[model samples]
Each structure stands twice: as structure tokens, then as C-alpha cells.
Target chain A: MDNHELFIQGSRVPDRGPDGDLMTLNMGPQHPSTHGVLRLELLTDGEEVASIRPHIGYLHRCFEKHCEKLTPPQIVPYTDRMDYLASMNNNLGFAVACERMLGLQVPEKVEYLRVVVAELNRIASHLVAIGTCGLDLGALTPYFFCFRDREMILDFFEEICGARLLYNYIWVGGLSHDFPEGMDDKILRFCDYFEARIDNELNPLLSFNKIFIGRNAGIGVVSAEQAWAFGLSGPSLRGSGVAFDLRRDDPYSIYDRFQWKVCVGEGLVGQLGDSWDRYWVKVLEMKESLSIIRQALAARPKDGDVREAVPGRVKLPVGELYCRTETPRGELGYYIVSGGGNLPERVKVRAPAFSNLCIIDEISRGALISDVVAILGSLDIVLGEIDR
Target chain B: MEFAELLGHIRAALPGAVLEEHPEAFSPWILVARAQLPALALLLRDDPALDFAQLMCLSGTHLPASASESDRLASIFHLFSPRHRHKLGVKVVLDSADPACPSVAGVWPTADWHEREAYDLLGIVYEGHPDLRRILCPDDWEGHPLRKDYVTPATYNGMPLD
Candidate 1:
């Protein structure tokens, strides 16, 4: 068969042969299962996929170009737009990178508050991951259930930052606002309520369903070696049983102080690196995030100025820093280069979804077309992050 | 192994390959010649004493317009050795007149898209890349947008832009 034809058409079927059964299909850019504007070019030999190419850039906003012109503090809002689901985590990553560049030490209360909101955002982000994976697998009930819990987190975020999806709440040195009166108690209550509901209601309804397991288990398995080589991070890598979480392995902020377990896939329903394991990893991580939220709430500083270290006009000396934070997806790294100016010389975002999405063509090579969706869903890519 | 010792080992392994060392930078980096990157990457990954197994991030940077052509573009590689729990930064500078460097995608598959992204945004060619197509921008897009001297077009596909 002609490799040239396959590259252009993404099909293995011979162009001149009448008996060839290979077909090429386009999956997204508008499809619901894609979760965003992602187009998957699929080459299928009947039901089994021969090859797949993911076409992105539908959401590219030239964020890096925009950052070069903006001041250090101005870039915080742009970071929020990349991974819209976990804006708090994105803001925190940029904030910490700038803070480290300037050698600014934030207040103790700021660190604890950052962790509290970041972990809360992690739970919200993972809820979307779990809920969408269920929806992609033809189970609709869990999506609503997951969203119901996620809405409560968003409500708390709204109460704190006044925005639901893209809150530019995290400034360079501190937060945009302190937690309002009695907000910590509300977060504590939500944590308690979320833990009970996830354990009692959501787990049995979706995670433990035999149909869900049968659909996801052993589908699109990525070996530990391939996962590392392809730079898979966050839950997808953990699902391969690598036991690497930046929060624990590369301790940043106050995560080292929190008491929580890094959840790795045990292959409960399938091979350790299968799609099911990846999905299950996200499910277990929500519980760990709750545990962290509980601990952070209990030990949070009672009174301190969250913005004490925040300078009115932020400036940086000539220097460079690379800071990686554990986002809901995986390791979100910001490499900032300053040329002794108010604006960064260069800002490069090492988006986890970009690396995670790169592995799609590698693992989806021999799997069936249906398994392609299962694998893509399990990867849990946000196009905002990938395209940015 | 600590970062200094890791650099010491690399320096010993490949003499003259370590061009410059910034030990005091926020993320201490070592500049290597572009031609030596692939070998250095292989050594960093395979050497047990300095097993930088994972390529954490690859960023392409363009020097200011005032800089000469010989120092126009650079690629930064942030590597992490999970076994040692240590990190190192490797930088390779290239001349913009012929901004090309040996591809490390064969050594680390993750570098495939990253190199492509660097090539896409900064016009730095990753020589020997499997398929060096545009990643974030369209295949038919005109100029590298991230370059220091890039000028935005007023129209793309006849769409007006102010």
C-alpha cells in the first residue's frame, strides 16, 4: 500500500483498488464527544482504526505573543484562559513563576489560601474529567451527577472571586481578594458534602458499573515506558502506575505540608495503563483533593494580609525561572525570561495537555475506532491548554 | 545526584560541549552548542549517574532584533530525572540565518510536537524531525508569529484585521 496516500488521506486502503475497504473519517471540531474544538482524522479499516491524526489550533489565541506585550501582572488573566476548567491552578502557576523570578516571599496566609483554592479547583476539574469520560462512554447520568457537585465548587469560587469560569483571582504576589467572612466554613461544608456524595452516590453509579468497566477496561492501554517517552503527566501518567505527582515529587508551595495520598492506578478492572485505569485515577484523585482541602482548611492562617507583598508596580531584574505546578491535568510549567523590565521577555507555557495529546497517535494506532473515543476521553485534554 | 555534580559529570563526559554554565540563575542552565544537543541529550538520559529520563519542557526563544544573526534563536530543554529527583536545563543557541538543530524526537518522543511548535512559532528548523508541520498555527500561515520582528498581516484569507 502507498504510504504517501495514507499521509494525505489518512487511509490505508489502496486508491486504485476496488476491493479496498479502508475509509477516512473526521470526528470533531463540532462533535459533542470531543468536549471542545478538536478535530480527529481517523483512518479506519472497517471498525478498527489504522491511524489517527488530531488537528488542533481552532482555539489558538496567540497567548504567547500577547504575553510579550503585557506587563508581568497583566499576564495573570491570560493564564486563566488557557485551562479554563482549572483557572485557579493556571493563575497559581504564573503567579508563583513571577514571584520566584522577583524573589518575593508572599505571606503565609497567601500560600495556604492558594493551596485551598487550587485543590478546590483540582476537584472541580477532575469532576469534569470524570463526568465527561462517563458521558463519552454512553453513560449520561454520571455527567449530571458530576456537574451537580462541580457547580457547588463554582459557587464557592464565585463567592470568593466573583467569576465562575475564568477568574483572574490569583495575582502575581497574592490573591485578588481575601476569602469573605464565613467563606472557609462554606468550603468546609462543601468538602464534607462532596466527599460523601462521591463515595456514596457517584462511585456506584458510574465507576463501579459493570457496563462502564467493560467499555473502558483494557481499551487503549499505554505501557509505562511509552507513557514516559510521550511525556504523559497528571492522572494519565499515574494511571500507567508511574507513581509520579509533581505535587509530591516536586514539592511546590504548601503542598508538602498537606496530608494526602498520590493515587496511582492499581488496574482494578483492566491493565494498569488502560483507559479504565486512567479514568479511575481521576475518580480516586477527587477524594484525595477533598482530603487536601480539609487539611488546608483546618490549618489556614487566621489573619494576615494576603496582599502585603504585592507591589503596586511589579518589576523584575534580568533573570529566568522555570516553575512547574501540579494542575488538575498534570504538570503545568511556566518558563519566564525577564530582561530587567516590567514585562517578560518571553513566556512559554509547558502545557500538560499538549504533551498528553501528543500520545494519541501512538496509542490509538491499532485500537478500534470506538476505543479511540474511549482513549481520547481518558486523556482528558482541554483544547484551551493544548492550543495555547 | 545534585545538579552541580550532574553538570560536572556531563562536563567530564563531553569536553567543550558545555559552552557556559549559569549556576546562580533561578533555574540554573548550561548552554551547549546546537550540534552537540542530541548527543548530550542521549548522555543525559542514558547515563546512570545523570539519568535525566524525562524531557519536561522544550521552549524556543528568539533573541531581540538588535542581536546579530549568529545569536538569533535558542531552544531550551528542561529535563527531569525522576530516579534522582533532580532537574537540569539545557540550552542550545542557533544563528537565525540557518536556524536548524538536530532533532531529539528520536530520543524522546515528546520532543516531536515541541520541536514542531518551536519551528512553527520561531522559524527554527528541527533537522531530521519526522514531520515538521505547523502545530499551533495553520499549515498555510505566512510568517512565524513569535519571532521578534514578526509583523501581523492586516488580512488572513481576505479577512480584515486592523
Candidate 2:
């Protein structure tokens, strides 16, 4: 089978238009749809993308190198900068790795509260993903609706931990601050409101829009076998009809207690593993995040010291620990090698976006240039994490 | 399969390649011969009983020379099986003089970028990588930045860094 037939069963554009002259097109380092400094060197035969070679590292900060120089606790802020959209998730992954290395168990209240904030951030991150994905397809209305709803999450994050964008609230031993008084009730209200907004306003406005569906459906299809081979996780894996979730499968933190469905894509408006399937998976995941947030809020203990287990000085055991948490995008893992010192011997971040971004060349081989943008938007990569 | 069973299976498959196994650690890790990395990786992916299909993370670290051991560069691959819900770590420690690892990019296509990133930062050469060019760093950049003794370049292209 040719590349076009491999992607879709009855693809109309089977022939590459009689082997047209190949043209090289550079998309982004600044393009809005490429999403944050990611440049794709697209080899195009007329409009169909012959292949895509993505050039990353415009945001490389050497996070692991910096981790070696700093103490374990000091590394939390650096983790925050990675995947800046899901900073709390990054903080939680690193904190879990450090706590595991130190053999530190946090309080019940801390566990409950950590779940709350992490889930909240998940919704916030997904809101940006769905919103920008809409904008990529030229739907102006949902972009505003998403940002307007997302501001509520940003406000809640700011109240909990002073920063709106990059909150390093989840510390290694425990949280940096208490779950703000009455904050739980406010998030509950937002959850109820956002659930309705997704169904009534955003869904009709962007997701089912005919032009948007036409653009995304059957575009840049990635098969399940290819997804596993490419090492995709999070929504990217789930989008391909795989029921692999670290929260469900791996059971990290207090996630096992909460009852939330892992929303694998069901080909709501397109072929299985199409760009539309991937995009819709993120939308369905927001509902699951809401369920998790509500459950975490209800089950959270009335009171306990948030920072009860905070160490004065750090002395970690000499061992390697690989801890992975389910971030909004995918599995955020921290592979830490501690050497019985204040500083870590090696800190390697298994960034979700880094792997998710690598699949472009595979799927974009026979897609239109515009479909490449839609497919990339569906992958939902944050270059901050990719280049870290 | 348990750690011992998997280790036994791997040992049976490639007896010469299996160096050591850490059963008591946080995760089941195996230290493998550097040259046998591709074979080990292929087995880990293809063997139905030990199906570790995903290369979740690939990291490279530089270890300073100690009293007992010489300077070495280590490449660690974290593998996971979605079907089995299990995890295993494979590590290869390269000699300091010529740090080269046979690329597992063929086993896991995702390892292509990971190996390039490792090559970019730590200078552990992935010998069989199709494109082993520096990924995070520019082609003109000198000296691997993640090595223990690496010094920050004061200037690049006549522009002062500090």
C-alpha cells in the first residue's frame, strides 16, 4: 500500500498528483499554529506534506543539568518552568520522585489537596488545548469562550498560590500552602458551570462545526500500533483507542480512590485515531477532570498540616527512582538518581510533549499543509517541556 | 512476570548480554552489555512474555572517575508495557575514552529523537542512529554541555555569553 492508502482506507488523494515538483516549506519558529517556537521543515509535493522534519530546542534550558547543581527542593522551581501550561503537574511529578527517594510519606490532607490542585490544573491545561485547537481551524468564537472559562481556573490558581501561570505549590514533602479557605466550594461551582459551558456553548460553537470537522476528520491518522511504537501516552495514546492511563493503570498518588473514567476516543466525528478523534479526547477528558476535582474536594480531610513533613535539610538515599504521574498532556515522569547528598546525581525528565511531538513525521507524510497544522494542534505539545 | 522471571527470560535469551539485575530497587533494572543494547531492546519489544513496547524515557548522564571506577557515561532506557502494565529499566554504561552505544532507534522509532538529544547534551554516541546530529544544541556548538568537567563557553560566534 502507498502512504495515502496506509493513512485512510478510501483516501480521495491517492496519487501524489503525478509526482509534482517537491517544495520545502518552513512552518514556524513564530507561526501561531505550530505552538511555541517549534519549527517544521515540511517537504511538500504541491500541497500534500511529503514529510516533516521538526527542529526543536529553541527553548532548551538544560533543566537536568541545572538539577545536578541545585538541591532536591531547589529543583521544584525549575520543574515549574517546564510544561509551563501544566506547572503544578510538573511540580507534583518531581515532588513525588523526591519524596519516594527520601522515603517520606505525606499527610492525608496533603494527598487530598494535591489531587484537587493537580486535577484543577488538568482542566485548565485542557481548556487551552481545546481553545487553541479551535483557533487553529479558524473558529473565532470557541477561542474566546475557552479563554473566558480558563480565566476562572487562573483566578483559582492565583488564590491558591500567588502565581497564575507557573505555581510551584506542590512541594516534595507536602504542599507549600493550605488549600485556601472556601476555595473548594468555588472550584466546585466552576466545575458545574464549565461542564455546562462545554456542552451548551463550546461543543456546538467549534467541535461540531462543519468546516472544522471537514478539516480534522480523516486527516493525519495515526494507527494504534504506530502510536505504541512511537511511545505516545496521555491523550495521544488514548486518542488512538488505547486504554492506557498512568492514573488508572499505574495508580499514582491518591488517584485510585477517585472514580473518573479514562476517556479514550470513540471516533465521535471521524475515523479512529484521526485528528478529530484526538481533539475530541481532550474535550471528553475535561469532564473526567471535573469529576476528579469534585471527588477530591469532597473526600479531602477537614484539616491537617499541609507542610507537616517538610524537611529542614535534605539527605536522600543513594538510589534511583523513576516516578511518573498523569499530567494533562500525558505521563510526566521524573527519573531521579540521588547520591546521599543535598544535590541530585542525575535528574532526567520524561517530558510528554517531547515524545508526542516526535510523531509528526510519521503521520504528516501524506497530509495537506493545512491538515498538518490541524494534526499538530491535535497532538497538544507544549514546547517548554519538549525542549527542556 | 516477576522481576526474577523476566530477568531469567532475558538471561536465557541473551546470556552473555545480561550483566546484572537490581531486584530490590524501586523498579526492576538490568545492567546490560553496551554492544547488546539493540538486541536486548528488540527482545524487550518483540518477546510476547516480556512485552516492553514503550521507550518511555531515554536519559544520558556523565559519571566522574572514582577510586574504584573510571569516568563513564551512562544511558538509561525506561521501558513500559501497556498491555501487561509493567515497567523495566535498561542501563548501559559506556567507557570514558570512547562513549558509543549501538542505537535502539530501530527497535523503538521514538528513540531516534531521544538518542539525538542524548548525543546533543552528554556526547554518548548512538552509533547506528540514522541522524545523530546535535538536537538541542546548534551544529557549531563545541563541547558536550552535560559532562562533569564541561566549562561554559564565554563566547559563541563572537557574542559574549556572560
lDDT of 2: 0.87
Q: What is the lDDT of residue A263 in candidate 1?
A: 92
Model 2 bad stretches (over 4 Å): A1-19
Per-model TM-score, in order, reads 0.95, 0.96
**For residues B1-162, could you state the per-residue lDDT of candidate 1 as single tens digits?**
776897789989998899999989999899998878888989998999887778999999998756543448989999988888888999998888889988999999999999999999999899999999999898889999999889999998999867
Q: What is the DockQ of each candidate?
A: 0.85, 0.79
TM-score winner: 2
| Candidate 1 interface RMSD value | 0.8
Q: Write the per-residue lDDT of candidate 2 for residues A142-190, one digit (tens) a residue.
A: 8888889889999998998899998889988988889678898899999
Error of 1 at B131 (Å): 0.2
Error of model 2, residue A209, in angstroms: 1.3
Error of 1 at A382 (Å): 0.4
True contacts kept of each: 0.88, 0.73
Tens digits of lDDT, candidate 2, B1-162:
778888888989998898888988876689999878888888999999988988888899898899999899999999988777778889999996899999999989989999998898899999889999988888889999989989999999999998
